[model samples]
Target chain A: MFFNMQLTYEIAGGDFGKAGYASSEIKKVLKKLNLDLRIIKKIAVALYEAEVNIVAHAYRGSLTVEIDTVKISVKAQDEGPGIADIDQAMTEGFSTASAQVREMGFGAGMGLPNIKKNADELNISSEVGKGTELEIITYLK
Target chain B: MEAQTFHHALTILTDVCIGCTHCMQVCPTEALRVKNGKAELFDNRCVDCGECMRVCPVNAIIVEQDDFSEIFKYKYRVALVPSVFIGQFPRDIPTRGIYSALLEQGFTHVYEAEHSAELLRESINEYITEYEDKWPVISTFCPAVVRLIQVRFPSLLDHMMQLKPPLDLAAMSYKKHLIDKGHNSDDIGIFYVTPCAAKIAAVKSPVGDESSPINGVINLNFLFNKTYRTLKNNDREQCPIPEKEQLKDFEMTWTLTSGESTHVNRRSLAIDGIHNVIEFLEKLENGEVTNFKFLELRACDESCAGGILTVENRFLTRDRLHNRAKQYLKDVSEGKRLHNKSIDQYKPYLKQHINIKSIPARSMLKLDEDMGEAMKKMERVRNLMCFLPAIDCGACGAPSCQSLAEDIVQKRAAISGCVFIQQSMQMKNKLSNDHALRIMEKTWGENRFDKDCTKKGAKDES
Candidate 1:
């Protein structure tokens, strides 16, 4: 039987300073689990980019991370302005970020592209008026 | 995954330690714990920062050093003195007087540790440019910080520059200088006058490289006292030593804060103090802190001036080094030509030996080698954590409730070792009072609970 664990963190949007808290906590737990450094690095980048994306766009969100010997999974669910075009949003330099957000060094539009490159699998679903849900997974075995 | 264990120069003498928990509170890595009426070290977790020694009430923690007589074994004895060692002396004592004192203390020759700092800066700039992909190249100058990164921040291992620090390069240059002068390598000894235990440990069991060029380490505090007595003697024999070139303006403060960062061509930040470094590194790892091309991180607060073994105040030492550097600049502007022994001549050989092997990451956070086993232990620790108090009182001999739970899951301690759990068990008639007392006695030795007037700050402390 595979040993599994789950961790959840509440993310407050628009607070750029408080972003990446969830990613760091997840990284600490993964380090303690004796995971491969390369896998951990991949997870760190993907999870961090996703975590920052929610802060850069949404009003509020929550992150749930599931870790096991076979695979690791992270899902970011946020309640705010959602992406209208998924394919276009995934393109590099295709940022819809405001001047203020861009000034903060976030919302480079490389968020989805980075998450796509680092994660083993990526899932995205959203409504225009509502929030967006992003699922990112990486296999360990 | 690395088989080589970390070597620590600090020793906790149980005979002298009273299990006061002063040291247990200050360890940055949580490597120290009170056990059996004494503090014990977890070698892998300890980076030898010497913070514990700084806070120990009884001065029970000691940084080990080579015996003075040991230097006599080599025909050509060399003391590689760092600038901080000179910073400890009063401003009135000239650098030449200190050098003479070292010679009188059985050293045949002396070499300044930062003589290679000039070369080190050039090499570091080249390395930063060559490895452009690895932005924010972390300096490997501080050995304690190197070990800290190895154990705690293993993921950031790639960022650590493979280049050796000035001390290592200086030692290599000194050894080569002696060997080139027809002295056998075996007959030459290079001892470092270190300001902290971390340097002692680095010389003994170096990281990134196979072996250190240093033959031994002499703690700064011990050597300071030895020279202080010699300087006080008015009738002391004088050694008419040749005038060797002292540190240049930038080189004098090379070991101080902002020394490396001030010289680097690109964007760089100098972070001193172990806790500050940890906080900044946490942000860097999560991609929060960015844009810096290089980071010069030191473990001590004021860089080497705040070394644990240093006798003088850190601020005073820093001021002295700054003044010393200013004085050197004034001398240069007055057309005083610096004499001889230029380390710049050996750049070819120093460059060849400066690049160290890649530093491997060794995560101390892992509960076990296998991922499956580590997951199991993590689960057990989480389960145990629920019943334990989170106050982090060191009564359980472990540093905190979390660590005690971890120790219990690893079978190094028992859940009943917790006083709260013992009290509850006694209330439920599951544990006898005598049994609880025995458990405590086991954790903290017998008679540890007895009232003693000789404890720190007590009336009969003498």
Candidate 2:
């Protein structure tokens, strides 16, 4: 089915103050759509974790969200130094965050795991010396 | 469906309101709005925290509590005194004197809310131990905070501790005590000497229960002068009231901030002040604040002592409470523990069937009534926000730039309401008008055209 609506947001890297703005806005949109609270919660958790990952690691990122009758799809692409090993990074308690980021409690290595747990489907693609892109889809049910 | 009746404990007198926007600015829930040059409250959105009452400079906002005279209607009147009310008096007055003063004022019996708080404390400990997996269990004692969760944090509703507030529990315990003493339940009326407007509302319309055990709420400030007079007129030589054992230090400190958590004695967080609580709740909802078993959130700045209806200064009252608690602890250490078995005897009055229902989101904040249209309008609002100055000056009659953007999209307001937009539009129109006149002058040679056009018009008329 065609998407009923779409929204996009620009996220600046290291901008901790506004890290969750996009996810919160999407959450509000989903709430207005009258989706199940549990579904909205899962989407919020997944999107927020992905958004924060971009802010913490990437130089800049853009999040594009599409909502349809059946599901919500989110695509986040960032311009920054790419991950060296996807498998290692996805492991719990594995982090390459700076000391400053760790101090701010962002480098718990739970971000990807949390996103994976909440999203129905998650796709990650990255190239060395390039940027990273994450695609997350959550069913309305 | 029948419309739900909300308790408007805090009301604004429209005639006295100055429309200064101070209350609207400070409101944590964004419940207040300056409409038609007056402050208006959305009843469903308001939590009756008395924040507006405190910020209103003209004293237009008033807390509507039950009249103290209403207690006379009942044959048996019981006063449920909050711990904060006891700390409001001078330090020299013995706590027993306050009890006797209540009795002298025609109350058949007076029960301290602290006792109920102790019971609730025990219940909470048991609840935490049993539901150990439910991390970050929020306190349900503050009616305003509970209502806030209902309105703003509906997702966190399940996290709320399902227990009756101290005031309600106290009334229940008092009723049982009176009934055990052979007085009929129907003849007795329970009155809560409340420190805040939220408590008054709670008594009138309880959160979890269909009706409250508390029949009426008398504001502490309203009864302060009368209680003081009663204490002053009493003869010191004739002490008719027996001295009861002082409350434990932890129970006595229940009226102040962080007091509730000190009893939990675990990984807990105590957040006071509505704004601070809102901030913490947002973090909590986002899964930022974890590893804590309990969260004691109070809507008032210094908890109950900072209530708007209280007469005494909070800091001073807090100090006095601490001193009294220290004395009570010293007495307890001397093998003088008060044997109050009521805590163990009575169970919580919270009904197993009834629970607090979460309220729906306020429609006033919605961009459109239709979800699809709202999404479209949300996009438009985003575009409008880009053009806005983002200064949140409130010059456009909206609280912030983002709100103005929403108002513009809702068609309740026009983009021209923004001063910057209005000035730019005016300038653009002026520049265009000037350009049109300049073109007319250049094409028609100013004076020559006026003369030639007039002559030609006269010839054509002839």
Candidate lDDT values, in order = 0.87, 0.76
| Candidate 1 chain B, poorest ten consecutive residues by summed lDDT | B1-10
* Candidate 1 local lDDT, B1-462, one digit each (tens): 112223588887767777877788888888887777778888878999999999988788888789989999999999899999989999999998889888888998888899999998899999999998778999999999999999888888999999999998899988888788899999999999999989888888888789999999999999999999988885845564734768787888999999999989999999999999998887887666678999999999999999999999999999999999999888888988466655777899889888888898879988888988888888888888889989898888888898898888778889999999999999999999999999998889998788999876889987
Which predicted model would earn the best TM-score?
1
Candidate 2, residue B51: how far the Cα is off, in Å: 1.5
DockQ of 1: 0.70
What DockQ do the predictions score, one after another?
0.70, 0.31
Off by over 4 Å in 1: A98-107, B1-7, B236-239
lDDT of 2 at B329: 83
> For candidate 2, lDDT tens digit of each residue in A110-129?
88878888889988899877
Error of 1 at B296 (Å): 0.6
Clashing residue pairs in candidate 2 are: none
- After superposition, which runs of candidate 2 have C-alpha atoms over 4 Å from their true positions? A1-7, A14-34, A93-108, B1-7, B232-246, B337-343, B348-370, B383-389, B395-397, B407-462
Q: Candidate 2 lDDT, tens digit per residue, B367-396?
A: 555556766777788788889999876655
Worst 10 residues of 2 chain B by lDDT: B440-449
